[model samples]
Target: MEPLVVAMLLLLLARGHSALGLGGRNMWLIKEKVLQAREQRARDHVRGGQRWSSAALGSAQHLEPQEEFFPQPLDHFNRQNNATYKQRYWVNTKLWEPQGGPVFLYIGGEGALTTYSVLAGEHVDLARKYRALLVAVEHRYYGASINPDGLNHRNLHFLSSQQALADLAMMHAFISHRYNLSKLNKWICFGGSYPGSLSAWFRLKFPHLVHAAVASSAPVRAQLDFTAYNKVVSRSLSNPVVGGSPECRATVGAAFGAVDEMLARGESAALERDFRSCRPLDGSGDYGQLAGNLADVVMGIVQYNHELGIDATIAHLCRLMANTRLGAPYRRLVALNANYMERMSLNCTDNSYQRALEELRSEVVKPYGVGERQWYYQTCAEFGYYQTCEDEGCPLSRWLTLRSEVDVCAQVFGISASSVQGAVDFTNDYYGADRPKASRIIFVNGDIDPWHALSVLRNQSRSELALVINGTAHCANMNPPETGDPLSLQHARQIIEEQIGDWLSRRPLYPL
Candidate 1:
């Protein structure tokens, strides 16, 4: 594999955050940043599960997982179309009891899955305790499950959260029948971020298929104008708990404000040189891409705040932005962006609109965007979690507006901006958004994770409990209990385990 692919693989292993289909990533760079994680599993095995330099922090423990595939129907909702596609999956029976064990199904999101996905992380730990059968199904249109008909508008019509949930239900039957699973063996589903939403939806849609669900940093609400996303990012940047301060957030806003001034002044040449843009920022779209990439650096740091792999923590970024010797706020942003690019092994940051369009418009999977294109289609059709900056207290440029983002929907998929709102409403109406009338689901979110703004933070009901960790970021509870973990995160995980135990034991989480 190329160094670029390897470098990108490291980011994908983070697992909780999204390269596409989330608030922070809705309008972010689609080119170099879209290194879909399909290849990470193979690379990790070659390097022996330790390719990630940071903590391997949340990686699974199972080694030598048995890989398999099931011929899943392409259009699960279409009863007539019997055309099936081979869906890749992995099973680890290391901890399963010979007599009977619970099935811990790891639902893949917008990307591929590695054996590490099935073997590692918090769910695997639970699987061990419960002696559960560990199985992971790659989401349709991602990794080896990409539909053979291609990603055209017509083919992608079948790709929706509704259909994906059906895929999960079908997989449950396939795996249960294959394992000879009986009613004694209950199913517990797990996922984070977009997959996290899937986990919640799976329980909501098919209560019989899954007994319980643990959704981490799951954005259950779908909205077109996700301005609240950056609003939360702004707050997180000011959170002193994670090394953020008023000055840090102020500096970010000032930096983007200065960049906007430069762009308005038509000083594209100097701006490109300062930010190390690979191409000239000639048009409005390229300029918007530049703004989006700069904002992406801050958004990613905040979303993955204090996570193991990301070297550039909020503290590191704030320190760079605070250095007065860096000159102005734009200069400080330049320094920070420089560090982020270097961390990702990127030589020159491409801020070309046409280049991004080429990636989004392509039918075949590109090396860079293995699933981003597919994810973009989903956002256009179903969920419009576009992280725009037009809202108040936004630290990024105003040019990264809902209009600019919805334009991608129009340009590539011909999805009108007006239609986007309808799709988002449909998603929320269908799944019940954050307040979905579902039982036996524990929705987990970290205060610092912007996606939390859309999750179930408060206790909606006893059965549908919400656990929000005070001093943590995206999917913090989903990682194994570490020494440096905050007390709140530790407690949150305990509550999750308790809930799972109750669900399995048939104990009512709430009394009537």
Candidate 2:
């Protein structure tokens, strides 16, 4: 038991917040002259619609964007026994507008830098219209960055949040030093969702390196109420507007319930076969019916509100589900059912505590409402992450008791809870609320986010804590139009950009 506990401890310690350890806790004051220079640069960039003034553009102007491919190794899941292979990554800088202003280091989430760069260009003033040169980079796990082979779970721990933080800090430093802007430049980091958490963590670990951060829809809390999000999905599915007849919800609920029973009995054979046998979502399952099935499930989770007509939604899924009739009611219903199925699968695989929590919800709280099955509960039991209630029937009261010992291996930071907590604690102590540091960290969460409303659970410095309820969304509002901006919810992109712009300008934040 001691050894097991020790191993767990070591694993946790080796986890995320690598940037904090690497960046160190140093209180560096910006020189008065540097402050004046940065202020001037900010004004100039905002006025000139560029990141910096013409005077700020130095030798970088003559130096074209360096387009070079750098091959790196990737070893996330593979253990260290086989031969190591190499993957490729490209590093380059464009002629950014914020030449003399603060540098915006945008590290993209889970895709090629180009993919994220497009999103950034749309939401942000890429011409350095308001701030500094935007330096975007790719995530290590995705794209060209890769680890070595034969690296098992233990070794891959290096790929945790700590390493990511260190990587971003290093990138910032590299650009600062290379561009000779280290003395003249200030750093502002921003990202959404996975990258949003990364942005928040970056400021926490590298306060000295960064001035402020804008984290949108960041999932900082490890244990969140994902089951609640699922409830939203069910509610939406049952709504009549989307063609969900009264029976639609019950039938779908029954199907999921069947799945739940199978999981409780430790039977995944049926699901595995169902997944394989499910028809294609489109008219045919050329890519395989399973592909369409997976899409329907995931789309429901993302809840992407497309202007595409209901017929299009129905037609697309029907094709994926291999249903020929574009107007078939059964196909439409099945498509919505696929949404619940896909989301449950994701919650089970991506979240560590999702499965056990769902089981508990079903046993305890579910009786009062609907005794429906969720994907997370079934997946958890099937994957051996947790067990179901037995003998005493529904042990709802004891459901919470099971969580204390449950070990969740799935984490975005690639670290354990304790180590991540330690990293956060270090940040709080060093650059906490009372600290008179020039930099201020702002954390934003959509009220609907599972991780929302967790300030009560954690000890947050109230002065340092800033929560923005974006009309019940999942992430932070980047560019908000005053407090009561009346743009459609789908137009969150504009709101996000405006808000971040305000932060960079050091303008007063309005409304609540």
Candidate 3:
């Protein structure tokens, strides 16, 4: 489902490690996670050591964006901190009209940037039609944007949506100057998942800069205990549109239930062996981690259910779960886990709580910190999008409670578990939750994607529209139109195209 989530984290360490790439979703900590190892490794190479170049990010012959960097301030709010860092950005003017052509900025999410963001997509196709300049600005903390000062909790204090927004504001100015853009050269921001939220917020906060926004699968609302997330995952399992059924959902629920029963029966050794836990179950935390890892398999599937129609799909998983020939529910879970791990190229599921604590405690920002620690820092500080499984009908084990997740925040960042709700409140207040008063922003979401539960699923106004495509997965419209795509998905893209054109043709619908 990595390919399914292709949320591709903005889950940062998709090839091997798992981070919150939305914190869990980027960290595709919140959104869909992309699953291909080759694609994930390509992003890692550019992020770890390799410099941004055409060769590093696929072929330019295939319309790969030319890698460029911006001298961004290390701290935008604190003028005293005059230090700066090179923020990565990519631009392609191959389709620019140079006269009244808009700038389509693809906002990079919680993970690293890939050539695919700029080279291919419905936005790129729109760029071709409107003769717009296509650009993608990498989020500061993620990818190669990591600063050398440190990755300590204190140092990471600056990594937040607020700072990322400021970065976008500055980049907007820089790009406008370089390209001679003006009010006539209206800018439309584009993003999916976490970056999708950024797109809508950019328009909300900086309406003077961006004329329109396309926020696909964006979870605009910040939630401390995202129990509803699992509820949607449970429902998605039985969604017949995407090839799901009630029997399948029940089997999935039963499988996790059996896991809990097996644990109670003192079958930790068997559990570890069957699920291939990297470390032996030692304590309550270890047990919870094991359950969490298994749950993520289902989460990834539902989040990006039918994306790419590749391996480890929800249908394939449901079949495995419901297959009577596979033996009991526990055995079915074991088989599903094996298939998912092999597909994800994971040698062993690292359900090590000790290692998790160590990594979060470590001051050193290694290659995979962007997906795990950096994103989690934001989760603890700003958006408490902690995916908990305490929901009534969640298919995951009960071990994955809200406290189990918030405990990490308290231990690592000194963010009290009690204060997480306050952080979430502040986020919702700042962004207006799902009721943002922004205009010309098309909030697109898929019914099957759990993240959509937090997004604007209904139209708030004539200008601030919402497009809820049925049977589609996370950010399905953002991808290039593929053969055999859902009709709703195809229709949503067409509407998005027409709406963007209308926004361009008319004068400011809302006050500038």
Candidate 4:
């Protein structure tokens, strides 16, 4: 009886062991199936993105082509810093070739990918003809390129112009190596507005690697005078045909003066005319045509053309206030005026406004600094970004406190700011050390653009710069001038295409 009981126990133990092993195998199989499914889904998405070219995020599995935006999910290999902090980037490329034509590395400005991609799309044909790969990368803390817990003031201290230049250089090297492409080919760096500043720096820093660079509306001078630019804004408005009326000019001047008075007095009544004559631009909730005019005023002041800027700006206001309907002409004018103003406003508000606000505080408590004293201290304390005031504005008023300690002339413009200052610092920086070798650079501008001071910078740049069109708006390459304009805009397009094609065919023997 004892032997029989022992045999039964041994049999039961063996069966239990076998069942446990089988269960473990089944679990492993399930996990493998799930992973496979995810990979397949990812591939399908990638395939869809083939229709529209995509910027890459690295992936373990091979990506496929498709006709949708973000068709597939790319994987990232996170590398942590000493603090266990990780930075994220998308490094996968679908259309990279080893010995392709010249690579056009297009850096983006302050805006998101939507704006960048649109610009890229417009120049797609030329890009393909050059056998060039167009890369549109997002800056840190902007768009999909995010740094988790990286946007606060403390961390943002790292996101300076110097760091941004480093980021561009690193990305360029990484892409060239990863795709097995020859870095020796012509590398053209180009961008407008904020990114234009980056382009200028990139050319200066990596002169050997970059064959050519085109920077438009780039503000390299750290200490820009915002109040001074009102001259340009006023000039744009004084066009004889549109804004040149005597009554229009008087109204604009009076309105601006009132705002100045209000700023000095800190009274809400100073905004009475601006509020009364202004009504919301159709579709814009509370914003009015007056806001658009104010933008023109600000722009005119920047380029030393205040009379035209103010005249055009006020005339535009009159036009808008007269027509509550928000018709086609009004819309077009508003768009053109507002577009230039938008960029101008943002730069002043972010870089200049904060400085002015700080200056105002210091004025009452202490002596004034280098900036305009009257404009430095404002009576109002509650103004915020995107919130336009009817009273006077202190564009450079905010930039009064924090003096940019960086040597703008020596370190930036290839000159010493200790001796010279203002736009000259920026002009010398762009033209002196960062000169482009290749003759394919193109400068596109609108005649009436408030930021036309950019033209002065272009003129200062080394030779081989071509102004494609004379527009009364911003970025009019895609939007050509009407039939009679003297500028050969169509010819400009042909020249651009031919030059790009030639460069791609035979890479320039640029200095490296």
Candidate 5:
């Protein structure tokens, strides 16, 4: 296989918090922000014109239960240990043909599998098309697929990608045996973002288990300082393809630079007052955290711009920034902060600056949730794809630095920079780094997605293909097709279907 393709397969299984989609742990933050924005807009419209009540924002949709549990070994590589834990899985065989059909396995990522709804729509459509059985397996330690031991540093040792892949292989065997479907040999894997990486890795590691795979927005390469993430965000905000405004981009750039200058001049009190921070900025750590949060807000908007509606678009953000009525850069900054607060339903008396600092602290300790802790552990152990502002050219450099990121990691995981480096090196060496040997996998990524830069964009073999969709957001092709979708996305979906169909039709040399 080509170097990029191999790297793609290796990197695909690892999750990055910088990107959007169901695969990352930060998706809850994105979902809440978008939902709150929509709700606030609806309320504003009602107050302005007529009396009306909108449906509850961010309400959960009722999904029929297809869940089950299987006992998975704690250490797949060590049979002597003989410890097992329950692994959660769901099956939707409603679209399957009676005799024998292809099984479509949807791999889970960093977050709880229950929060995963992307599989219910587009994957369901794909399953119906192929008359395949749809199976969704929750990653070990995520959701209810908890390890018998608590999720401290000790237990997380078992939560590696290799172990997760082993879990999938065992789950497949159990499912086949339980359903009496051993004769149904064809199995296809589908996932987006981190799970997208998993789907690709599944085929690469166990070709005999999975005949084909669709890995959407799967970043295959791991880097210590992921400066490309911010670079891509900057490009997305200025690119005409995404309807970005030059004036808006200029205003944002200036605002970031201005903030940096102010902080450098010891204007923390003024910043606290202007930005409405809950607490005073004590040191560079607090300032850096605030800056990172602001950058995350911008990235989150661009990552899910399609779902946030026109008001949340790059053009819209630019319009807000460039408005003469907004007065100085500080005022524009406040306006931007206010917009994000309202959208995220962050109803604290503390300003955005304060909240940003608090959020950073929370992410480090991750006391608020398991997903953050679990995902961060993976990063510390296997991949150090820390989304840092290493690129000086990027606007985000005003507030973040590589030092701050490394410090956060040290504080959170009790590991030094050298330890992280060692772990990253080990991961790269184990997973083949840039020379992965994999086949029969379709890698898909959107041009605008920050993670796309890390994925395979070239054909490595006849069976390994890369599909890049233009004028699309993260994992756009994996979602249900919309009337407003770009032609490239539509074409990508068609090609994926064709490739899968071809894979399913081929006879397997080895019997199940």
Candidate 6:
């Protein structure tokens, strides 16, 4: 579905505002939604006299056996302290010609590397075209690349972007020696989202290693209070060109206004009962948590919007919103939440704010740190992309202040607001924000992505290109090519392909 239409539906239903505040519940809802969508799609296929099976859904791409590890320094900056850890990585040489072809290296970010396919369809296609080797390296302190001691506050000091990039550089050298692929002189770094930012940074900091980079939906800038995120969400919802209905927009706005009035009048109890919150709404902290949780539902759907995939799109969500049986704004929101729950296949049972916070705290030490705690640690210590409703025209309630998000950082990691602010400032200064000291990097972002505002939207150098796709969402170009893909996405992919080809045809000019 078009981003604008989905935005309109979310706005009208106030699904992007606040609903259930439970993390587990949200996940459960998403999982259930995806499963239901798959089932329905399968039924549609059966009606059309086509065979439908789970294998069909899983046939998009496959990864090779990824049981490789590289020895990495615990601290890249302090070489004397020789504490080392194993960093995981994957390599696919099926398409590699070995006659001096470029290497396509995917930089993993914040999650388990095992989940990443050694070859995404599009990346595989690119490798075939360039006769390039496909490689994916896990970031330090993520996935199986855990610190030998543990992921305590003290151990996490080595998990910064600088160390991660150094790890990648070392991996490049290790792979070259291990595989005897030194003839493949050119390297092109590829990644999506946070890894995208890392890919661009790798090119910038270690140009000798990476000849070019493809940063899909990368947010290079560091902002403590990223209010622009919600503003883009608002714009995407109301854009007339994309078929966003003004009526829906106005209705959502009015509903939020009513919510603000209720909050002002101390109707927290009434809200709790109406919204079916698992816990009582006693204070601003609770309210902010609720708002953030609700906002996450909308943001997640919008971010992962795809054309031919079962992933929830704005169109699917809008249809669900229109057909919901519930009455009253609060009831309508609850129903809409159920719609997302069905669409995303999330199997959450409890929808309480307290329970969600507890789950976050408990999952800090889990493998790959899949919980919010690990990502929050990066935000507090490195890039502060805190999605706050501190700006005007935000869809969420004003009561949901930026301080609440900062408080989470402190509560989770024992870090202070001042320290987070300092870290953000340092990151900006170190990376050069949108105007990084880099070249031969292609920065791609969907116009509808909330994080697009924080990304480099304009070419800062001759070789650095920023391409934006219309009516698309985060990392659309990175996904497998679909027949229903928008012209903009297709065009962006073509440009990326051309850039990679051109970069490979040329020799590196060192000592820039």
Error of 5 at 124 (Å): 1.2
Question: Positional deviation of 296 in candidate 2, in angstroms?
Answer: 7.9
Q: List the candidates' TM-scores in order.
A: 0.87, 0.51, 0.88, 0.53, 0.83, 0.83
Any runs in candidate 1 off by more than 4 Å, and if so which? 1-62, 308-310, 366-370, 507-512
Winner on TM-score (1 vs 2): 1
Residue 398 in model 3: lDDT: 60
lDDT per residue for candidate 5 within 1-512, as digits (tens), equals: 22442243233224331111111122447754543443354334333422211331112232234467899998999999888888878876555775778888888877656423323445666776878877888888776787545376566688888899999999989878877776565788988777888888888888878878998988767677778887887888787877776666667777776766665566778777665666776555455545655666667767776767666666677778778798976578678877876765665223233343234334232212236567766777777777765455575534455545555566656778788788888866765553456889888988878888777788888888888888777777766555678788888888888888898888758865
Question: Which parts of model 5 are misplaced by more than 4 Å?
Answer: 1-28, 31-63, 115-119, 349-370, 433-435, 508-512
Per-candidate clash tally: 3, 47, 33, 54, 6, 24
- Which consecutive 10 residues in model 4 have the weakest lDDT in total? 376-385
lDDT of 1 by residue, 1-512 (tens): 22443343234335532122212232243222322221342344324532322232234443457678888788876779987777779987777874657899999888767666675678877887788888998888887787656587777777788888888888888888888998778899999889999999999999978989999989999988888889999998898988889999999999888876665555789888988888787566676677777888888888876552445578788888899998998889998888877767777777877788887888884322337788888888888988887655798876666766777788889999889889999999988988898988999999988999999987778798988889788777766555677888888888888889888888445652
lDDT of each: 0.76, 0.39, 0.77, 0.38, 0.67, 0.67
Judging by lDDT, tell me the better candidate of 1 and 2: 1
User: With candidate 3 superimposed using the best TM-score fit, by how many Å does residue 417's alpha carbon deviate from the native?
Assistant: 1.3
Query: In lDDT terms, which candidate is top?
Result: 3
Residue-level lDDT tens digits of model 3 in 98-195: 88899999998677776656666778778878989888999987777777664765568778898899999999999999988877788999999899
For model 6, the run of ten residues with the poorest summed lDDT? 16-25
- Off-target runs (Cα >4 Å) in candidate 3 are 1-63, 366-370, 508-512
Rank the models by TM-score, top first: 3, 1, 5, 6, 4, 2
- Supply candidate 2's per-residue lDDT for 260: 33
Off by over 4 Å in 6: 1-63, 240-243, 263-270, 279-283, 307-311, 316-331, 344-357, 368-371, 508-512
lDDT of 1 at 368: 23
Note the residue pairs that clash in candidate 5. Answer: 6-436, 11-220, 12-197, 13-197, 276-351, 277-351
